[model samples]
Target: MIVIDEIYISDEVVEEQFVCDLNKCKGGCCVDGDAGAPLTNEELNEVINGYEKIKHLITAEGRKIVETEGFYHYDQEFGWVTPTISNGMCAYGIVDEKGIVKCAFEQQYYAGELKWKKPISCHLYPIKISKSKNTEQQYVNYEPRDPMCNPGCVNGQKLKVPVYVFLKEAIIRKYGEDFYEVLSQIADQYYASKEAKK
Candidate 1:
């Protein structure tokens, strides 16, 4: 484990490889999950406030789910989460012509319609962050979602991209550039030490 401040990062985060293969996975991560995308308290407010701006991008069914169930709901396991449509796709999810699912919030974010891109949990996918009940420390674990993430794993292996490198933008966005720099340095040393042993 790599300890940085209050965060405890698992070795897999720096050792394992992953790069989302959207074409191969067809964005299954957005639709295959049993529950909707998890949201923080602040993110709930952001989704509520920004929904109107991105509503046009959502499908009619998605809008209906959101309009009837509200922007989010409480989950026993995931706490606050976005509501899923009848088809199990997130209410904020949009399907492109290619049948690939996408996040409406992300679409709006890139279009400059919203400042917040999407939920941080969604942004840092495959790397789940959970806090310890006994301590104030947060654990960051690399947990790829079974078959849904298989294509990404294969792609990452082919590209030789570590999970941390593949998720650099999200890491920097969540933990700042300084944290990412330190992580990169640590990862370099970790790999170098392994190479030396070999």
Candidate 2:
């Protein structure tokens, strides 16, 4: 593990390569999960405030679920999470013409309709953040969803893109630019030392 500013980062975060292959995965991460995407307290407010603007972008079924059950709910294990449809798909997920699920807020944000760009948890996918129960130290772990993420993993290896590099924007958004810069530097040194040893 690499410890930076008290955040414990797993080795796989720097060593593994990953870039989303949307065409193949078809956004299965949004649909196959047992619970909806986790949301921070601030993000929960954003969803509540922005729901009206993005409601039209959501599917009828999703809108109905949100209307009846509310935008989000507390999960026993995941804390606060977006509501899911009866099929277990995120209530904010919409199907595109290609049958790919997309975030309603993201679609509206890209179209200049909303300022918020969906939940950070969704943005930083394949990398999950958890706190150590005893110490409360945050851990950054690389955990790509299996089968759904196979194509992305294969694509990343072929392109030689490291997981950190692929998630540059997200890391910066979550931890700040300085954190990303330090991570990049550490990753470089780690790889260089590994190469020398080989």
Candidate 3:
């Protein structure tokens, strides 16, 4: 239950951690990342406003991409496709002073107490809030994974429960009650399991 978040080893981060050669692995997840999850009115407004503030900074090509790409999630003819920031290498990924495309918004947009300018789904990663088609109950699992992800942390550092609780609060609030109910149930099971162990 606790060790589920590392479900996917985004190709870019994977190469960063191992092999030391990330050239082949273009940081796709952070740039484009998830196919957009739902955004409540408040969240949606925040994104809209934020994009507006930065719109001037956006290149002509970037603006074109934005209009076409829509939100991190969007409607498609076949069905729906969530938006992702990385279009392979992302249009916004500018080279750093060190000469590498910055993979994290935090690294670039974070300017002291003003991280709001940098991230939207900051609370959303590591956990995926979704529902199984087979069952109606909503559930939060570690992000849907790929092969590169494994027990990357030998002693389990990155995906620990504390990190989940603290770092992911914004995402939790956005997810709201449907997800809250499911989490409460999982909590009950956790307590029960602990009691049994004792």
Candidate 4:
């Protein structure tokens, strides 16, 4: 692990490669999970603030759910998360003609409607951030998993894009540019040290 200030980064974040292949996964991460995308207090406010602008992009059923249940719901395991429809699809999700589910917030963000793209947690997929127990330190870990995200992992390997690099923008969004600069330097040295051992 590489420690920078209060953040503890998993070595796999610098070693493993990952790039989301939406065609293969069909944006399964938005629909297949037991819980909705995790949300922070700030993100919750953003959703509430931007709901009106992006509400039209959601599915009819999803919009109804959001209307009745509000933007978020409480999950015992996940704390505050996006509400889900009967099929477990996120309330902020809409399937395209290709049958790939996409986030409404991101769609609106790209369309120049919203300032933020989506929840930071959703933006930073394959890299989960959680606070260490009984401490103020935050852990940044690579979270590539099987079946759903396997295509992304494979593509990332083929493209030689490390997890940290693939999620560069989101990392910077969450932890600022300076933090990422230091992380890049540390990753370079980390890889060099590994090569030296060989």
Which candidate model has the greater TM-score, 1 or 3? 1
Estimate the TM-score for candidate 3.
0.48
Clashing pairs in 1: none
The residue pairs found clashing in candidate 4 are none
lDDT per residue for candidate 1 within 21-46, as digits (tens), equals 99989888888886999999888889
What's the lDDT for all of these models? 0.92, 0.92, 0.41, 0.91
Indicate the residue-level lDDT of 14 in model 4: 92
Off by over 4 Å in 1: none
Which residue pairs clash in candidate 2? none
Q: Candidate 1, residue 98: CA error in Å?
A: 1.2
Error in Å for residue 182 of model 3: 11
TM-scores, one per candidate = 0.96, 0.96, 0.48, 0.95
Name the regions of candidate 2 deviating beyond 4 angstroms: 134-136
Clashes of each: 0, 0, 12, 0
Off by over 4 Å in 4: 195-198
How would you encode candidate 4's per-residue C-alpha lDDT over 1-198 as one tens digit per residue?
899998999999998889999999999989888699999988889999999998888889998988987889888877889999889899999899999999999999999998989999989997988887798899999876678999999999999898999999999999999999999998899789989999
